[model samples]
Target: MLTGNGGHLQHLCAQCTSCDEHAPSLPPESIVQMPEQNTPSGRSSQICSDRRQCIHGISRQTNWVVRSSSLPQRHHIYKISNHFDPIFKLEAPDQISTDGGTNLASEEMEAFFRRWLVKVHLSSAQYPESNGRAEAAVKSAKGLLQENTSKGGALESDKMAWRQHASHGDQRVASCVTGYLQLKEWTNTSGIDRGYGKNNVKILHVRREGVVHSIKEYEINTQLTLNNDKDYIFGDNSDIIATDSQKNTVYILAKKHGIVSPEDFALLLCTHFLSKYPYVEKAKIDVDAYPWRRIVSEGKAHNHAFLFSPEIQHTCTVSQRRGGSAAINGLTGMRVLKTTQSAFVNFVDDEFRSLPDMKDRIFSTIITASWQYNTVDGVDFGKIWANVYKLVIDKFAGNPDTGIFSPSVQNTIYLLQKAALDEIPEISKISVTMPNKHYYTVDLSKFPEVGSLENNEVFLPMDKPAGNITAVLGRATKSKL
Candidate 1:
């Protein structure tokens, strides 16, 4: 069954470690005897516990020492240390309240402060009160223009109106400053005149050094995909592969979009290699396809055409490297599932901490996976991404016995990425990043005392901080060949 450069498979076998099979399955009798454990009162009953009833697989009030293996032996390991310092200055301000003991509304004071800062320091120094001058100039110019204009034809009248409007705008600055100065006391205005005028000789300085900031406001374009024909939908699938034995250099099998569907339009955006630039036999070529569907939708339930959305996704990538250069890339989303495979333990504790037991708590995070493809020389490139996604999911849920129990988010990421590398016939390794979005339940049974966590009560709060982020890196092997 080996095709095209079969010797490459032999080299892979030599480099790979032997797969181990130590997974155990429970006996049938034990399953029949297992009774559902339910409590009459607490929080939620969804939390599961082992036969030993340990919360999250850890004991409470116990300190676990962590040490780095790379450290020098001479350095003495310190187990636990605690120090305290005030996080913020809580001293009362010295400002006296003018309005009794009633607290001032911060919103009103903040607005007034912002206005003061801009008007006093930001306005032009030479024309501090330009409002009075701007208003008087505008009024004098408008009065002079109106005094000369007479009733005339539509065209003549329009011309006179335009001239008057422009003349008014020419004096707008003097009018604005004149209006602002009217609000202040005329006696207080002596200070403004003394600062700018000297020896009854006026001096003018052209100040054009002021900086003007322009914020380019933009609207978030959410509907980025252009499916004008409504072609791509939930259940649609496609595959593109390059085959050496086949007559065609590239072969693609895509599900037909809905009649007048633009699903393929979205696909084209995603597959830049195929759409932006494509090739067959080292020559540029455009993709040619004729639409075909299994059944036409007459009403509800016509033949099982591609559904709008499906819970399962299966994709694969296969490529042959010209110079022993293999690359893998993958993206996985919408594989939604609800499980309590997550657990949290190994955290520092002090006197302020009052968490119940650290035995069996549910830890969960939504998973998003993307990885590059690494190909061995002359290996099957048709099914790489598909295999990678499948292997990762299988390792996460299917191999619970060996994969993620008592596992940190970092451990889960390493295992998931490794599983993908294992089945990827030629891929050397994979890089993965996983964010741990914590789903915690609030204990709200009692007012002061939070409900005991042991009663198996659980609630999910969405607006909370995400857990730790873990990433796996792939290191290349360099040899002097």
Candidate 2:
């Protein structure tokens, strides 16, 4: 089956990210080659028409054949409001576009979409024909990708040149689909960070005797991956770290490091792994820090009290190879909105453009700023984080009494990144991802008394079909957003 990239659905991002759990699947019970005739299989166009006539007989099943889900993402998307979504733990998209397959084109599907507040766009019959049956093409591409291992340069042969034009969506979707292998199916990680040892994760809390796991519930999560030549090349557990040791080290390290910030803690973990083991040539660490604020009671803050803050989160990722410098990256999520002083105007217009040019409108966004630090030693990460956080919000709203004008989100991102680089030398570069959260003025033309959102001050906020704007600014080159 050709699985399309689910990038538009933000919830799928986590599922697509690489994890050791999706390691190389064991060899299937049976491996069957493509049939000589290339005859179409009746099993959704894959299996033979008659089970008894087939060579494998009635015992044959899909799990018997070697398979790969490395399919290219079509320009369009398919969304069904069926058990497929809820079983996958999705928040569901605001709209769905699909090929007019018999399964998708039905009153029940339309009713489900409408009841769930989902917009449905059905692709024309011709579109599906143009897309065509891609299973053979996908299988060919997957074979080529697996066979070639030339250190990732330009493809040498003319036959492979077409991959240069393949969209990133195609490559990403193919790489990450092998998640949680089936009991009898075979799969591989597509030569991306393969691991064979036990991989364990820990959520920090005082795990000592008489200490409830949720007492502190700091909500800090950490994962460590160590690599060396022995385990990977020799196929022995020589350099492998035990599961118990990993859990113990995580707890002990938390007590030693005191959890200053995610960046610092992640860096510390990376460095320790590199230093402690001679076999560990490379160490990568990921840490997520959640917000917990001390409770304030009666004009004073409680020392031993706190409340879980779920609005925003901080993430730190650190990686280092032995005898190499460490790379530290941090991300912060913040939400801010302004009622006025924002406008989006004069955009390139075509037949699809229906939005009238906006002016002095309400603009809001969930800000995700990703930055890499050039220097980590003797740096005050806490203070720098605070300053940068304040700076972005302050820049978003200039002269608090009356905010500054924002002509476009692109310009605002560029300005803030530029300002941040100017403000802090420790940061090497900054990339800002801000999705346009829209608030449309309630039309009062029916009443004929509100005077076009002037007399009646009311608006409706939307959470879907958000505009995505992102750019990176660096010391070496200032990117044009």
What tens digits encode model 2's per-residue C-alpha lDDT throughout 263-364?
776677768777897546566666666677768899977655678876677666666676655545555567889888888899989999999998778879
> Residue by residue across 9-70, what tens digits does model 1's lDDT show?
23422443320110012111111111322322111101011112111100001100000012
lDDT of each: 0.31, 0.53
Clashes of each: 48, 1
RMSD of each: 37.1, 20.5
TM-score of each: 0.33, 0.54
